[model samples]
Target: MRPTVHDIAAAAGVSLATVDRVLNQRPGVRHVTREKVEAAIRELGYIRDVAAANLAKGRTYSLVFILPASDNSFMYGLNAEIRQAILRSPAERTDIRTIEVPAFDPAALVSVLEELSREKPCGIAMVATDAPEVRAIVDRLVRAGFPIVTLVSDLTGSLRHHYAGVDNIAAGRTAARLLGRFLGPRKGEIAVLAGSMLVRDHRERLEGFTSVMAEEFPDLTILPVLEGRDDPEIAHMLVADALSRNAGIIGVYSLGAGNRGLIRALKEKAVDRTLTVIAHELTAHTRAALLDHTIDAILNQDAGHEVRSAVRVLKAKADGLAVIEAQERIRLDIFLKDNLP
Candidate 1:
């Protein structure tokens, strides 16, 4: 039989109310009493039925997801997953809403965050835009006793409780290694297309890519990054211009959204066979590019997994419950032409 609170209270020599406080992670339980209740629960091997308890408590986690308003495959998928979460909201007793801010606009994000802070939702999960103002806002929210989760891109110095994204530095290193090997031992120049340096992910990826390229492949040269702002039109123009200037471009690494623009640029220049390209996200454009040999490899992070991870972290933090760190860690999914689903 499952251990009950009554049993825990009796074992710990505490009142039922005290046991409830300790068991449900409520505040004001003295440290000594919490430890005693915890020990008793451990001795009895008690497993908390969190679902039933939440239902009984009538707890509803109100969370807001701040996403970027970019017309990219990853963002689209992320928004879709949020909608799916909303569909499951009733069953889970969650009130989840999303706010779309302009892509790479730190000021706009800061304004939105400031506005949301007034409402004081249970928690907030956001795609962090790297800027001092944004960091300040995040710190302010944290100081105000809010649980925050950084999604997709993370901020450098902030009080965000968790991050629901890949290790971007490692991802960049991976892309560099793949690009280097795919290009063989031949010396050639590589061009990179990025969303924005204001984004930590893009910056980290560029850092990793350059570090690897400089250390491992000294013969290969990496050109300056072209900021496309996750806009296909901008990416197309920038990449097309880069290709024109550096006709010896043997490889391309797109470490951000805007693959459609890259594809359009490649098509406009008819670069189907010459270049070995690596990009992020396994969207339809990229997948089709892989199938047709436009892109050589793809490094993907599941948007759905990120959304779910953020929800889990926010919900757990809101309830002051410990989460399984290992279970919540998000991974980067790599896809090849031969291994794509």
Candidate 2:
């Protein structure tokens, strides 16, 4: 039979109240007494049933997810997964809410975060805008004892408790290697498309991509990045213009959303030319493009996994529990035409 708190108290030669205080990490328990209880717990091989305890205490984790208000397919999928989590909130004893901030707006995000400092939810997970003011506010909130996690995109130097997203630098390096290897011996400029440099993920991806291209593939040149704002119309126009003006461009690297516009531009403008393209995210547009030979490969991160991991980490931090790092590490996926899933 499993040992109970009463047994633990008896073994440690302490009162039941003392044992309860130690177990709950409440003040007034002397260090020596706490050590005795811990030793007794170890000797009895006691495992805490956190779920039962939370239920008994009527604990409800109030978590907020701050997502970017972008119209991209990946963002849509992420929002859908969060909605699904909300559907399961009742069973999980969680009160989950989402706040959609304007994409890449640091002032708006900082304002929301400051307001949340007053609101003081159990936890907050945000797609950071990678700005100094944003980081400052996040650090202030963390020092004020708010459990914070960065999802999808992370801040440069912040006191965020955890990050729930892919290693974007590694993803970009992988893209560069793939693009270079596919276009072996080709000497032409590569047109790069980005959503914005204000997000850490995009900036880090570009950094990695450029580093690899310069070191390993000296023959290929990366042109000035076109900021499309992740808008399909802007992406279409920018890419169409680039292809029209630059005849020496033989490859494309799209390290952001708006792949639908990129694909359309390739289909219309580069129909007579051969351009090897590598892109991020496995949306419908990118997947179809991969099959049709528009995009050579795709690097993807599971949106569902990221959302679940953020929720789990936030809850763990709020409860003052240790998170399993291995379980929370989001992985990168590479997809080609043959392996579409």
Candidate 3:
């Protein structure tokens, strides 16, 4: 069996990113790490010809960014990042176009994917809706020899070439731990606001949050998840309603976008009670809330980094080159009022 980069990563006890850096002769690696990877390569008798691989697959990429038509600040930031990538695409030898489908609408997204499949671009990157039909379309695209990369929200059980997003389960677990510590040992109910359970990212975050809360903070009970559809008005209404009904709800875990609404609802009830809020994204609204002590912590994934990473993955898959998994791994940034950038 031909040893792959995955095998090298395991043997060296290092990340794929380090292996790629070594294989491609890129900078940014410690001397000890480089020696370990080289030793592993020698032991396995492995050879890498990145130049030959690139020669076989010439550059000139046609990539598509299929994003949701969400009004939230996070989606806005994502689109902005894509635009920035487009500006830089010429030098990278890549051409990029973007399409927006209705947020949370499985049928709408399916129609768009089908249309793109016929065109057969070099690669397709999308924020997938977690529906069986959507998954089937992605599988079809992959089978048709198109490189499909899922961005932000992933499509599980599909033949996706790569995923450019954070580990949502870990994000949720972190949120739970922070909320538990902030709330102390007081007995109270917690409200979780999500975009929808249909998206894999949100579901994973919920699972992580619930599991950790149950194991560590028994006193903090998680209430039923409220689907806000990433809409500010909807989220605001749901939060207002939840707060009114359960006075014991002292903490909130917002696992999705639409935090503007959450902020509005919290502001309205800020005088009545200060709900310890931990939400995703570091948008203007969230930053303001954090500064004023309306929100305790902000869990963020860089929208710009995610878009650029997806582009790189798509280009690599199109060129039949290996991806640096560690380099492409999207980081989860934890933001506090003190550290606002």
> Each candidate's TM vs. the true structure?
0.89, 0.93, 0.80
Candidates in order have lDDT scores of 0.90, 0.92, 0.90
Q: Evaluate model 3: give its TM-score.
A: 0.80
Q: Which candidate tops TM-score?
A: 2
Candidates 1 and 3 compared: the better one by TM-score is 1
User: What lDDT tens digits, residue by residue, belong to model 3 across residues 138-189?
Assistant: 9988998899899998887889999898989999999999999998878899
Q: In candidate 1, where is summed lDDT lowest over 10 consecutive residues? A: 264-273
Q: Report residue 305 deviation for candidate 1 (angstroms).
A: 0.6
CA lDDT for candidate 1: 0.90
lDDT of 1 by residue, 234-316 (tens): 99999999988877899999999889999988977854448889999999899999999889999999889899999999999
In model 1, the Cα lDDT at residue 177 comes to 95
Candidate ordering by TM-score (highest first): 2, 1, 3
Provide the clash count, candidate 3. 0
- Residue 266 of candidate 1: its Cα lDDT? 90
RMSD of each: 2.7, 1.9, 9.8
